[model samples]
Target: MTVSSTSPSAQSSATRTQTSAAVSVSSETALPTSETKQAILTQPLFVYNPEYIAFLNKSLATRSPEEILEWALISLPGLVQTTAFGLTGLVILDMINKIRNRRQLAEHPVPLIFIDTLYHFQETLDVAKRASEKYDAPLQVYHPQGHDNVASFESHHGQELWKTDADVYDYVVKVEPGRRAAIENNAQVLITGRRRSQGASRAAIPILEIDSGVTPAVLKLNVLADWDYARVWKYVQENGVPYNVLHDRNYKSIGDWHSTQPTAESEGERDGRWKGEAKTECGLHKDYFKMRANYLAAAKKRKLTESTDFVLVDSEEPSSKKIDS
Candidate 1:
């Protein structure tokens, strides 16, 4: 979807009647049960003790990304990769392809999960399709609940929702969809593309850590955590990995079209994302409980407003009818 030029406040204040219903339905029906949550928490496929995880991080620190991937493939259960088709993710995808070829495997061992925010650049979309096809990896794509594309999303939530309420927008477009993908895939470990060089919240990220944001904590393997932007670019060039074309235009890190921009040569890789904002990582990598709470609160307020308006209209209709009669 193309980015709209209208300012968020200036955008039409369309009532979100359909969006409220959708949110209510999803909150009621899509959330996992207590038993299911317990199962996901207690019945982990691998040991996730803090001490053991620390040991794994130290052990994998000096190893190559490929080596890390190989170890994870054999050891980590329910492993999957989440990507936005950035340079780092593409490098990992290429490495996975090489690993699969060497092992003579028919299918890539680890599948991929992509959250389509419906506001991504056209270049990002093209690369996702191309990379998945090239690697023969299983890609499961998820979107915001009730809406399939940008037009429907804007029609219900109003145009430029991110400008109006960023937290609510992030929850709907990225956080919720990512959580759903994880649950549906039964993912216990996620291969991520985060790196220390990205700065901000990622400056001191370890090679692996337990992600407690979502229900039933899952392991996140930053296979490229120790790698720098130069190294990542070198690997991408040597391996000819498919990546977003925006990189050619100075867009170092890519997200939704509205929030992403091109970084200067001296800037950090992710400087292009959410430029001028204090934000770094998207809500997908943040606390799921907090984001959900905020989104639910917003939805409740909207519902109440809609209900109030309905009552007022209903009460006035009879008087107007009597006057007419």
Candidate 2:
């Protein structure tokens, strides 16, 4: 979390008080202990509590990056460690490596998960390999089902499903696969690479959150939610962390191969991705209700199509029951 010092008089008269006051914005207030956090997250109304956000804000405002990570180490369990093939995630992964090397935490290290949409740049995969080997952390990669590679996927589902009908694509390719990973791993919590200064969607994102989706049974921890992009880059450089080299090409945010691009614009960071689309997330981190609604809608459509196929087949063959009648 990013800790800042600001007083009412600092803006108006810094010379008047001769004293500096710092506010505690560490990400430690949500859950003091990992076990306690696990228990509280499963409880109802954990997401809606006003104090929860306040605590997150305070923690991020006052704590250092290392301190925030320590809080995560002790306060998050059942953690589904994740990476986005981004610089920030790589930095966090490096820190996580240090934590695991301490021997005690290594015994119960957080499991790593990567959402392999098969649309990633080759460099991304290479970096993933390097990070895994260096940390010796078991990394699990989740890909869209029923296909071995992107070529087969595109051939069957069409090349533009993500563009023409994004929601269905998101469900089948991203959300469903991610949910499967969580369920299979019995993940009661998830870790992500989200930061607040990114935009309005994440301006108030907490360091720790109770993910009340599908089931109010999982927690989501954003360890570096308060770190800015500058800090992330600095950490990666200092640690010599392995990261996607595409960031150098102006791809501030990277995703599928076809969807990702290089942007030279000054204001936009993720704009180079999914060009001209308003979609930031691919539904993995979206609300559970929204994901369920999309999934149900797609399922209903599939059922209708199946029913039509059955009727057509019957009409062509002539039903034995009708003949008997």
Best candidate, TM-score: 1
lDDT of 1: 0.72
How accurate locally, in lDDT, is each candidate? 0.72, 0.62
Stretches > 4 Å off in candidate 1: 1-47, 215-217, 304-325
lDDT of 2 by residue, 157-273 (tens): 667777767886776677766775666554666777888867757777887665657323356677788777788888888888887888887777788788889988575666776
Give the top-scoring candidate (lDDT).
1
Worst 10 residues of 2 by lDDT: 316-325
* TM values, all candidates: 0.79, 0.73
| Tens digits of lDDT, candidate 1, 290-323 | 9888887987887623211112222322211100
Name every residue pair that clashes in candidate 1: none
Show model 2 residue runs off by greater than 4 Å.
Answer: 1-53, 56-60, 103-108, 212-217, 302-325
